[model samples]
Target: MKHAALTGISPAVIAELKNGRARTLELTSAHNIITLTEAAPGECIFVTSVNEEDLSPGDPGIMVDLLALNIGMRRIEVANSFFYEERERMSARIKVQFRGITLTRDVEGRKWGDPTKVEIVRSACYRAG
Candidate 1:
């Protein structure tokens, strides 16, 4: 992630939209410094939001949830984002892969001489039915 932030774009997610409803996961990173969360659920399947950086990738939960939701699904992978907590704002890099496709993005405010706020700068692009 940091590596990509240095060079260019960060990681990202690639897949078709199964269920547009967002599923957030707060997992402590290996260092336990970052607690990722689902960004706000933006527009539905086909449309893009005005604020592209704020769109969520639609995480539906664990395996059980996936089984239930993926009934009529073909390709679905949603983990393209999470908002950082304001208590400790920092840079972020995310990379997600699904069906052999990889997407990534980076949010580096300090590197650009700006205050790192609690926000996500990555955007998820999904193929609509």
Candidate 2:
């Protein structure tokens, strides 16, 4: 039984979207943070979001896109994303296809930054889809 999963952020680079600097970590037994200039075309990657309900109760997987991540980062203007309580149960899986290699990450505490309050909550990443 595979309880742990790996996700990829396959798509255009989100560094600009994030507004903050985002470094892609090399996929190895020991996670290493690396920089991603851009994602090549025709590459396939997956971003999986899981909730507490799915963790213990078990349920379907949540689908998310890389554009959302970039948007959220852009909206917040920071690379460090924190999810709201509602989203606390939810986790994000980013699968990015850089060059010929595919990279992924399990991001937690992701949320949208409120321009007014500055307290970022509700991620726009999953808003579109």
Candidate 3:
């Protein structure tokens, strides 16, 4: 039997989660960092507290949606997203429709004047369900 596709969560974390061990998943954004702890007894996922690093002092931070990752026999789903702040804060959710190979380049801490020029590289092919 084929195993579920692994995305954001690492192999070690998955193993621990399956074995009733506690673990934390850290996710960082442009200006803030969030940590996801274990879910409740029946729940399989947890969400992190909202971070407001990108917001100015006294300004309310944009509320991000709850993220979920499902590992199943037929498909895997990872709710990943990125947030950008301009005059108005906007969020871009990264979604994949099918199981396929993906390539990513990490440019953390790279300084660039133009944010729009930056891009995320993704390539995928969908299989019939």
Candidate 4:
């Protein structure tokens, strides 16, 4: 989750955030908020502790680093229809952080399963390194 949250992001996603299509996101294992397009390359995004936090959408316990503009933090978790409200509450009631990236997750974040996870703050493409 940390790896992807820091890397694995695509230019299109970044563009979306820049265009307002995407703005907030969540992380797995915890309900925290993170902003896409506010983070930069070569940074780290931190969320509430995995065990202590709920991995829901809209959590405000998300934060990122501030590097330049090559890249920015993006949403990582998407909530299921069954657990929307629960996720949003958690997402908006916590605190998180990123290493060098600039934005933080928002209340209505997006989620992508593992494997596809990408930490744009710490990675570039989807090629196995």
Off by over 4 Å in 2: 1-5, 8-23, 28-41, 49-129
The residue-level lDDT of candidate 3 at 53 comes to 24
Q: Against the true structure, what is every candidate's RMSD? A: 16.6, 17.2, 18.3, 14.8
| Whole-model lDDT values for every prediction | 0.23, 0.24, 0.25, 0.32
lDDT by residue for model 3 (64-114), tens: 122342221223344446654334232222212222222222222223221
The TM-score that candidate 4 achieves is 0.21
Best by lDDT, which number?
4
Instruction: Looking at model 1, report the run of 10 residues with the lowest lDDT sum.
Output: 62-71
Candidate 4 stretches with Cα past 4 Å from truth are: 1-41, 50-53, 66-129
Candidate 1 per-residue lDDT over residues 1-129, each given as its tens digit: 221111112122112212333332222222211111221122111111112234233412111011111111123344536843334333333322221122223333333233222222234553342
Q: Which should have the higher TM-score, number 2 or number 3?
A: 3
Question: What's the TM-score of every candidate structure?
Answer: 0.19, 0.17, 0.20, 0.21
lDDT of 4 at 95: 23
17-87 per-residue lDDT for model 2 (tens digits):
23333233223211111111222223222222332112222222322122211111112233436643322
